[model samples]
Target: MIQEMAETLDDSGSAAPRLKQTKQNRQSQILAELNRSPSLRIADLAARLDVSTETIRRDLDELTEQGLLNRTYGGAVRPLSTEPSISERHHLLVAERERIGRAALPIIKGGRIIMIGSGSTTTHVARRIAVELRDITVITHSFGVATVLAMNPTIKVLMLPGEYHATEGANVGVHAVSFLAGFHADFAILGASGLTVDGPNEALIECGAVYSAMTMRAAETVIVADHSKFDRTFPSRYAGWQQVHHLVTDKAPSDALRAGLDANGVGLHLA
Candidate 1:
């Protein structure tokens, strides 16, 4: 029966090896998204899976609590801080990142001026922009972001001047802020170390300083983070609830936090 199934699939332009790989990949993708946002609402999971909400809720609940997720109003979401090395980050939560990257792609219109913050998620967004968006201008303090976008010749890249942070691979300090102040961008994609019900937060004082400068100059700002970051507080504060324009998180937000952001006029985009 397995042989016959493979033969049938082969006739439909998918060989056994390819078909099996595709199935494995699809499973991996779903798992990755779940890992990124363990506490995603059931409705959000159904939307992502194209299935009924009940089914998703049941399946997610059965998977033992893996520190990756926490129960929410309807489903689960990822945790705030998962310490993974660069390679590990790339390997895990891959499907979720791809979905996030795709969703963010349309926001980066061709020929528009944009600025990207540093982090694993931001780095993925930058790479996707390089492949999909064209004839644009990007100013970033992240060495990784600049390198990722450097593949495109037409897209002008500006590396902000500042002291380098080894772990973040991004620039910081007065020089970075000074360069950002001179030019305005149509959009800004940023990341945060900690997420709270109130607003975006960070751990480093220098990061807070530069992000504040970037926000002031950007016409629109988008905060990208996985759902797990919710309900956590960091040491530094960057933007208050009223300052952000949009937030792209891995899962639907809690009602209270959602209401808080809405009350502050920040649009929420749950991926």
Candidate 2:
């Protein structure tokens, strides 16, 4: 009986396929999917990875055990509780920024006072505003954005003064927020470090406070971000979904975020 069982096991092709699903290979694939979507269904993972649903479920279970993901009813989701570093986020979605900025252009009317927060994506929005709109006043903490807008003859620039961060090339401090607090804008175009179930978030506490104040002071608050920011959390919480009037992001809004915004009665504009 032992000899016959050994022969059958050896002849079975299933052992080879099971052995092929190594821990390293599974983790890599899971990370790739997690990077693309904040949450994924088991069936979706099976389709994407070309593995059985059971294999994907096992992989997700292992990832959850490692604290890399949180396994839920149907599948798994990227952990929202963890905050990623700002340096880790530089230049992640450049193409998405351009797309988001282009989508935001028509919404920005000419000759209005606009408050732009500093970030790669928001800076791109400033560029679009400078090129498309005339007779506009731009208030920003971004030195780079100010320099670009200054080249346009019709656009007026108002730069808030504060301690400069060499990495971000933007000002952040009490001084910057104080300067912004005094002005009321037609629309505030802000960049977000992350977005969570709670709201739009920022990495720096001071920047979050300033961004929140700016949103409050503006008639409308429009958040411009790439898809990467969605469903992610930051160290600091700024404004909730209700505080935002509109969201401009690259590609269509995911069903999860869209549902959240819809529930809050906020509009979403996909670039």
Identify the candidate with maximal TM-score.
Answer: 2
| Residues 179-206 of candidate 2: C-alpha lDDT, one tens digit per residue | 8778899999988877766788986677
lDDT of 1: 0.71
What local lDDT does model 1 show for residue 32? Answer: 79
Tell me which residue pairs clash in candidate 2: none
Task: Please give the range of 10 consecutive residues that has the lowest summed lDDT in model 2.
Answer: 1-10
lDDT of 1 by residue, 1-271 (tens): 1211223346677655522223334334556776653334567656765657776655665442544344444555444454333444455456766677767776656339998887777888888898988888998888888998989888899999999877667789989988887899888888776677778887666877878887888888888877656666666778887888888777887777788788989877766
TM-score of model number 1 = 0.68
Cα error of candidate 1 at position 198, Å: 1.9
Residue 5 lDDT (model 2): 18
